[model samples]
Target: MQLITAHVMSKHLSLSSFSFRAPQDSPEKAIPSRKLPFQTFLSFNPKKPLSLKTHLPIMQISKTLFVFCLISCLSMTSSQEQGATAYEMLEKFNFPRGILPQGVRSYVLNTDGSFEVYLDGECKFGVEGGYSLSYGRKITGKVSFGSLRNLKGVSVKVLFVWMGITEVSTGNGELDFYVGPLSASFPLSNFLDCPQCGCGFNCKDIVSDS
Candidate 1:
């Protein structure tokens, strides 16, 4: 009777353990038993797939990138309209800003490349190499890609007399300034600064000379 009762108790304990253990042969049924909230929703409806938690961050990132690009484009357009100055315009024509002196109060540039430059007053300054130049109140010229034609209101002192520079041209890495039938050529690097009136190359020297 003791042996039969021990056998019955062991058989009953084995049945209870088997009932509590998860079955390995059927993983599909076990998935539903431990399904997450989002998993349950997806299982119910196969047509609507993505959850809000998964897609919300992607939408937010896309919106942020779009706003950043829009602001950048607007800033560039505003700068092109308001930030462009006369010196920067000269750069567009492949000329150095130093070709024109400072104190440009106003200017008019036409679509045909003809332009007029107005200074604060007549600019007269002696360059470093003993050359005195004078620019009139208004200077008119037709500017091409690398040449200037029909230039007026500019002159240079030669000996005791000042002669007008009627034509100016640049090519072959040199700049040519013409007066009537006479012309002079200098290296293109010479006109890098627009000399100031009455100051020459060094204003301090002019002050000392005075």
Candidate 2:
């Protein structure tokens, strides 16, 4: 009986020792910390002045900002060169683009203030009077904001007489039309309405064939 009791006591002590022992660490968790030269220097000299190591990040940031701004400016210039149209160019010169009727096929503007405007073909339509107005296939003139000179290829009929309108000048909110030595003044507001190729001031195709 004594031998059996000793055997049972030894078994209980061995089981308790096995269960209470600390768990073994994994290979990754047991890895030892490695201190690099720079890390060791920083840890030893915390109050030391920052060297190029600290300023390198700031320099890189500055370089990045400069590149970004340069790219933005280049993109803006590219868009302006490609996006601006002929009508928008008219606005740039401070003139309303409506002065030219619709169906303008093309135009050439010179640096010396001269310009040539082209229509698809000859355009004619009746105006306020029973008389008719006609535009040739091409018109050439010197153009400034609110003014056109040496005009050609446009004509109007008045009182059964067809007169060539040679020049147009603007001032005091009025446009002066020159037909030979005679001139007529009309409100500048009249040009706000863009004319059509075959309908003159009418855009809704209301002009009758009669």
Among the numbered candidates, top lDDT falls to: 1
Query: Per-residue alpha-carbon lDDT of model 2 for 1-210, expressed as tens digits?
Result: 011111113433332222111235533343233333432333333234434354554567778777777765544332124566556766666555656667777776665567777888888876553657778889888778767889898888888888888988778877677899988776767666667777777656574533
Question: Candidate 1, residue 173: CA error in Å?
Answer: 2.8
* Model 1 TM-score relative to the real fold: 0.54
lDDT score of residue 32 within candidate 1: 34
lDDT of 1 by residue, 1-210 (tens): 011111113443332222122367755444333334432333343234635464554567778777777765544332124566667777676666656777887776665667788889998877645778888889988777777778888898988899998877778877778889998877767666655667755765667889
RMSD of each: 24.3, 25.6
- Model 2 earns a TM-score of 0.53
Model 1 residue runs over 4 Å out of place are 1-83, 204-210
